[model samples]
Target: MILAAIWACWTSAALGQAVPNHADPSAREILPNPVPVPAIRFLTSADFPPFNFRDETGALVGFNIDLARRICEEVDVPCTVQAWPWEQAADALADNQGDALIAGLALSPENGERFDFSSIYLALPGRFVTQADAARGFDPSALTGARISVRRGSAHEEFLQRYLAHATLAPMDDEIAALEAVKAGEADAYFGDAMRASFWLNDNLACCSFAGEAYFRPELFGKGLAIAVPAGHDTVRHAIDWALVRLKEGGSLDELYLRWFPVGFY
Candidate 1:
């Protein structure tokens, strides 16, 4: 079955849950256009599915691509989006080949030295997926003695160790394996990237579904996803930030989120 059909099968209980909001609602300052650039150039990588990737016809498309266009439209500027190898994207931005990057670039201190980031637009939270029957009444914080499978040495595992210390940790080599442990009843639950798990639940696995609320520990999971401009490019950065806040206030950002993520992660 196609993704849309599969997603349609999701229980209304899950769909009714609130989607997480990243944009600050109070940041409603009217931004004065800083340094009017003729156009905005956006660079992205084509490998990160759902966020940025190529379709069967090989057209550059995905959430990030659409978001870049939206930002330009909101700023009332012409824009162009181009794909590059992940490794080359940062260099391309530094070389002035692009004015901004919409790819899921990690917002690290090291990266902060090289780029100025807009406010976080999305955050990938850690979530627990349990057998469909067991999902009801599931409380992640109370999983004492319950074995929870997670990617070995991942930030998710670290989060488990630090916060959900009551649960027994069953580390696996990769996300699929961790999820398989749960599907096969080797583990009581699986905790990992909510977005990745959502894809598996909607398109691949059917025995399990998300349990409880999404966990957001920015310190452990990194500071979520943001647009990046070369350091000192304050004009571009400010413009992007203004557009993003407007999108959130007008619910355009939420629409894009639901469109890309048919199976809501939160």
Candidate 2:
């Protein structure tokens, strides 16, 4: 049943969160450093499970951890991670607090005003979490005027704003907080990435059933997520892109996708 619990995670197909004109996001693309650097500082959110999380001893590990280290290997840099809340990542990157972030963040326009983003990686759907009432039928519109929970800086928050206009929102630092918000009845529903919504449902609220199809708005939702760097750090930006291109060519991208998405989804 342990693995069954893990396997029960259900999610929607995908979303488009890519940035246009990524070849020169900031007019300066990075070139790889042939010589390896001794240390590089990286930023990530610890709350997103299977993608990134803290271990029992308080170490960060997950798919993004491995993916980021591989990127560092290709770019000839050593990385040290600083785990912070998801909401703080953009501000930290903008203020030069970290060299890069791998939090699977969307390339929102507001974030673009402050930082530079790389190319698209993976696009997944945003889903709704409802308790499966006979009358409501789990439609996003069914719960209008109800309180909903979302992560403070996610593209899904934008989704809620546009789709569930009648609903009031309660923003939290992480998806887990949003899950708790639903459990505690502070919010009527929880919204986030489909994979994340599945994880939240599994780890906490199994009684609730999810509903609806994937919705995507490329302009508002972003093209997809790529690693984000400070606006001025062109050297690092292009190097990461080059590494991703190689990863795509070398079949590493698909391999990583298979490794992380075993149940399989975009």
Off by over 4 Å in 2: 1-31, 35-39, 126-193, 197-216, 220-222
TM-scores of the candidates in the order shown: 0.90, 0.57
The local lDDT score (0 to 100) that residue 65 gets in candidate 2 is 81
Error of 1 at 65 (Å): 0.5
lDDT of 2 by residue, 7-70 (tens): 2233332332211122222322345665543445779999987788988998898778877877
Q: Scored by Cα lDDT, where does model 1 land?
A: 0.83
* TM-score of candidate 1 versus the correct structure, residues matched by position: 0.90
Task: Evaluate all candidate structures by whole-model CA lDDT and list the values in order.
Answer: 0.83, 0.67
Reference-based lDDT, residue 110, model 1: 87
Whole-model alpha-carbon lDDT for candidate 2: 0.67
Residues 1-266, model 1: lDDT tens digits: 22231121222333464554565444457473835766899999999999899999999998899899998888889999999999999999999999999898899888888999987788777899999989999987689999999999999999899888888999999999999888899999999999899988886446888998777777777667899999998888878888888887676777788888888887
Candidate 1 regions exceeding 4 Å error are 1-15, 25-27
